[model samples]
Target: MKLYVLSAGAGLLVGIIYSLLNVRSPAPPLVALIGLLGILIGEQVIPVGKQWLSGTAFSTACAKAQAVNHVCGQLPGRQQAGQQAQSAEEKQS
Candidate 1:
């Protein structure tokens, strides 16, 4: 996809620049990756917490699951087409 290509290009450019400057990345690759993951999880907590506090049983659980799905739906390169398939199956029964 174009988005992936663009991101890869940007990362490659940064690596080249850093190499030319003889400077290390701001953090170790693993540490930086973990920090990014933390940021993503933190973004979903508030919305999911609000859903939990406002709803009753069954709906609350469904809402919480949906909230998580929505959060994950935003991640790059992930597809949510299967969610439609699940909805279709639910409707048939």
Candidate 2:
């Protein structure tokens, strides 16, 4: 949540600066967003592809590459899982 807020704030700041300079954005907002989405998904392709080529299952390849988490952001269930893991580690300590 904080990261999202910070990202929005940073974008807002840059928009303001561009507005003050009378500069148009490089791309339309919707197009830029879609392009960014593509870039994020594209980044995971190679790692996932390599794992798959090595005979790993699709789901396991994605998990090993953390492609879903990277593209979708850390989900609620993932956060809970991470917290649980931390608790278990602390218990063992």
Candidate 3:
């Protein structure tokens, strides 16, 4: 029982260190840089993508996708204008 416990503890320690030292999510710096750039580009691209997106999601476009893009682009401006108008009306009353 004591021997088994010691072996288990040793195995656990070795596994932990092996995972720490040999584990890698290694990416080439160029590849990582390109991936990061892709994300930034995609942020801009995804909105444009929605306009032409079809309802079919797999190969083409999606309706929800377009709606999300449309709302995200328009909502803030609409809200700000509404708020300003409301404040002006409140002051007049």
For each candidate, what TM-score against the reference? 0.39, 0.53, 0.27
Model 2 C-alpha lDDT per residue in residues 1-93, reported as the tens digit of each score: 999998899779867866887767896788668757976898899999999999999999999988999898984377889999999999999
How many steric overlaps does candidate 1 have? 0
Q: Pairing residues by index, what is the TM-score of model 1? A: 0.39
User: Model 3: residues >4 Å from true position, as ranges?
Assistant: 1-24, 50-93
Model 1 lDDT tens row, 1-93:
999998899778867866786757786888667756765676666766676677646457546556555545554224456677888899999
- Model 2 segments beyond 4 Å from truth? 1-24, 75-93
Model 1 misplaced regions, further than 4 Å: 1-25, 56-66, 70-93
lDDT score, candidate 1, position 12:
85
- If both were scored by TM-score, which would come out higher, candidate 2 or candidate 3? 2
What would the per-residue lDDT of candidate 3 be over residues 1-93, giving only the tens digit for each residue? Answer: 999998799757755754676643354677557655654445555654765563345323434344444434553357679999999999999
Question: What is the Å distance of residue 45 in model 2 from its true position?
Answer: 0.8
Q: Rank the candidates by TM-score, best first.
A: 2, 1, 3
**lDDT of each model, Cα atoms only?**
0.66, 0.86, 0.58
- Give one clash count per candidate, in the order shown: 0, 0, 2
